[model samples]
Target: MMENRNLFLAILLSIGVLGLWEYFYGAPQREKAQQIAEQQRIERGVDQNAAQGAAPGAQVPSNPAGAPTAPAVVANPGVTREQAIAETKRIPIDTPRLKGSIDLTGGRIDDIALKDYRETVEPNSPNIVLLTPPGGPQPFYAEYGWVGAAGTTAPLPGANTVWTQEGSGALTASTPITLSWNNGQGLTFKRTISVDVNYMFTVADRVENAGSAAVTLHPYALVSRHGRPHVSGYYILHEGLLGWLGDDGLQEIKYSTIEEEKSISHRAKEGWLGITDKYWATALVPPRGEEFTGRFSAVTNQVPIYQTDYLLNAREVAPGGSTEVKGELFAGAKEVRVINEYQNNLGIPRFELMIDWGWFYFLTKPMFWLIDFFFHLVGNFGVAILIVTVLVKLVFFPLANKSYESMSKMKKIQPELTAMRDRFKDDKVAQQKAMMDLYKKEKINPAAGCLPILIQIPVFFSLYKVIFITIEMRHAPFFGWIRDLSAPDPTTIFNLFGLIPYDPASLPVIGPFLMLGVWPLIMGVTMFLQMRLNPLPPDPTQAMLFTWMPVFFTFLLASFPAGLVIYWSWNNTLSILQQAAIMKRQGVKVELWDNIRGLFRRKPRTQE
Candidate 1:
């Protein structure tokens, strides 16, 4: 009863603390992000600056910095506040490097990131524009470029040998440039180029022959990146213990470049050109006598690889013959889903891990698959976590039932054990022997309780591994209040003083306060309820062993995704219900009001 009262008080205090923290910490952080974005918009001249009227005969010109210069509207009709707000609300979030394209037969690369290019380089005419021909002469286009994402197109200095076309499906904009080619053999080919957001591009080829001459051409393609030549670097996310997908999908091949020694390549056996870092690239195939085919290579200033050798070579293409080679380029983040999609589209095998352990193969894989499926279904990581938790509970329900039954049997024998201990007060060994004999005579298996406890260790570790490394949890969100599953609960309600430290990036301080304060308290109370219903037999050794369960788990969960915590909290509540149901079935009486009164009334006993 005292325990119950203490638990209730703890819960109330926790709720109060959580509420205060949320008020103080959470709200301001989220507001800060919104504020930053708003400020960026204003800086971008999307707000008030856009509304100012221009002087008569003065036109706003495009700024060289790639920012739009607002054309002032003459004051004709007064605009209302609501109208301005609606206009502002229509602004879309800007996502860079939106899309790209390429024209194979026409030999034109359009929609280049000239704006991004200009930011990276100075406006100098000395920089060379290099383009590689399929088999013939190399053509050099003089650098006549100055353009920005926010700037108007720069006029070319010489005749238009090559240039970009502005359109939705232009070659240089969206990723994985798509192109087509036709040779004199009357064969036409269509190919799609996809680069990972990382800038690793892949080419998928499809060829159709109009004239049947049993034509076969070994495909080889090359595109030039101009600069003083130097050694490059490269790396592939392969399929292994953890990299199952990348390894199996890519064909093993080796290559020797004029710039470096021979090494293994993740690029397909037929050769695929790609660049990991770089803003602009050009392909110039100056007439290779109609049977032409080739590929292009992109270069960047800095390579994004942890290991040695960073280089992606140019791929080869053949006339009257076609093969699809996929290139994946990563720019923003090294996310697995985006990588997997591009790899799969290139007809690469899915990433798979090699774990031949029989039990792991039988159990862990199925469990992972189920978890993955649930992750896909709900989309919200927290909900997926809850589902996985429930599934795990259901799977272990039988073991728990057996353990509970053993505890019940132990409780029944407590009186008998006490009698034997009292009778042999001075002979501990003899008492234990007598107790064992009585147990054997009663046909009770003394080890029943031990099996469940023993099995939990490995199961716990396995589940821990799954939750910690599973890619599905990355960037996944929960419902209202909790946005990012990977991040901590945002509600920080109150401060040490009465003031609230608001974090606008997250929910109002209320979120963290409830999560940190109220949540722990709820957990404690639920734990108390669980203890009452499924009480463990009083054994110091078992108690010490079981203590590690919570301690180790709490430590392990400290770095775990918040989604997992939510699942665990819900799981604890469910466990309490299960135990309470079991206790009710065993005829245990639970008087709510009496329990509460007894808890408050009882005073702690002091040692004499």
Candidate 2:
């Protein structure tokens, strides 16, 4: 009974963790906001001084040293991304992993699509659009250029500035494009944008002091989104603006938080800032070894615009001397290896943080990497998960063995313990002391029974985090009828695995619970069997709890990722076998079969 109580406490701890996790991540907050009128939307620029009546405006950064400001937002009643792209003169960008174009009007990397990823698991599904031109449904793009220092109005390149591309070929991994704009003054701004085989884009801005009164200019880069992006409303994954500043550590500001505050600014020697989705991101890495002010700001209109930008320190371009500042932009799918490579090779500060590894970064990332390694070796992610689980069990085998051994010893002495309790029924303190004495004499640790359950909590959550957040698991397949491991199991028992062809999840109220899938059912059954391996608790409330927890979890976790459900079910099965083996070795009764039969057997009536 003590052992059962300890187990019960450990299970409750696990449940508490899961409940808290679900409470924050599983629910969305809906806020009521008024829509800005069409005229107001058109009038709203990045800042008050930003030009509002320009013909072709770009998404401008706020207080950009009074540089060429955003062109007035022309409100087209029904504007599509395609129409927005057509409006701009673009230099084609075609790479192995990415396909997009640079908007020549603003010299912004506006239109980008991930070539290796799709909007859906279907092969014919459209490529995942990462960046889009302005005035579209989701106006997202990265712009890099030079802004004049405080009092210098040098007719700097702004949204309306038309840059001249030096070469005609499409921008590829090997081919770099240079867009140059002249101020008709001394400064000639040339931005050469180059991309790697992966997602990193290197933008080197060179300013030529031709006319030559020494001038001061600040280099700036920004990622702008014209409308509020549809986020994956989960606390576990940050799907808004986040960055790692030099001294300030990491700052993650949600869209709503940013809107409320208007702007968050940090002056750092080195850092990166960006807007991130669950699977994709676009970031601005300021020039290395330079002090810059990074700001995340939003302008709330009917359709809000969010921006993350950095303005580097003033660079004094001497007469007849040129100044060059090189920065990088990461715009693509957040693949762990790729992000890590850029961080290690190019020395981007805390760039891997863009993936939102959560509080368990130490455990979660390694778990993901291990599973990924096994995936490469086995050629199947599901097989990799199983292999990793076995490895984890092996690694913790000694601890588990001792824990089970203690549990088996405790179980074997249950008769003596029960007798002791009955003998001391009138004195509760005496009962506890005698039990402690008995346990000490038997060399049994009552807390040892909870060890296995305690060990499971972090590992379980780490695996969940890896599966839920990693891009590698996004469309990974397991076996027949199990595709997209990151998504919930699609085969729901309520629909007889789709034989009925009616969507049970469409119903209201109980609709979500009704979508209980096959893997969750298997997990529930394994959980039930695992619990039945132990003797039913003598306390009726505890017994009832032990019996129904599996069902409760089944309903609760039916909507979890298929991979997590698979891991949980597999882990439970392994634990049962391990416990049974230990019990047999310790000369304790393996009551699993007896417990199963007892559930069906009828008890004779005592008194009529």
Identify the candidate with maximal TM-score.
2
Query: Please, what are the lDDT tens digits per residue for candidate 1 over residues 1-608?
Result: 12223334434444553453334223434544564564354334422443564322111232222211111221112344234223221111112433222323223222122212222123542222222211111111111111222221322111122222222343332433434444444655455544433333444444454554433322222222222222111121111101121323422211113123211223222212222122122211111122211222122211100111112222232434433332222222223444455446544333222111223545555655666678789765566667877777788788766655554555456568768877998998998799888777765566554543355445443444344444444445677555556445444223312146744335653433333422333344554444444332234443333333343334323333465556556766776665545545655443333433333443411111
Compute the lDDT of residue 79 as modeled in candidate 1. 42
lDDT of 2 by residue, 134-193 (tens): 666557788877777777767888776899999689999998988898888877889999
Itemize residue pairs with steric clashes in candidate 2: 57-71
On a 0 to 100 scale, what is the lDDT of residue 121 in model 2?
Answer: 90
Cα RMSD for candidate 2?
4.3
In model 1, the Cα lDDT at residue 277 comes to 25
Error of 2 at 428 (Å): 2.0
Q: Could you estimate the TM-score for every candidate?
A: 0.46, 0.91
Q: Please state the error at residue 55 of candidate 2 in Å.
A: 13
lDDT of each: 0.37, 0.82
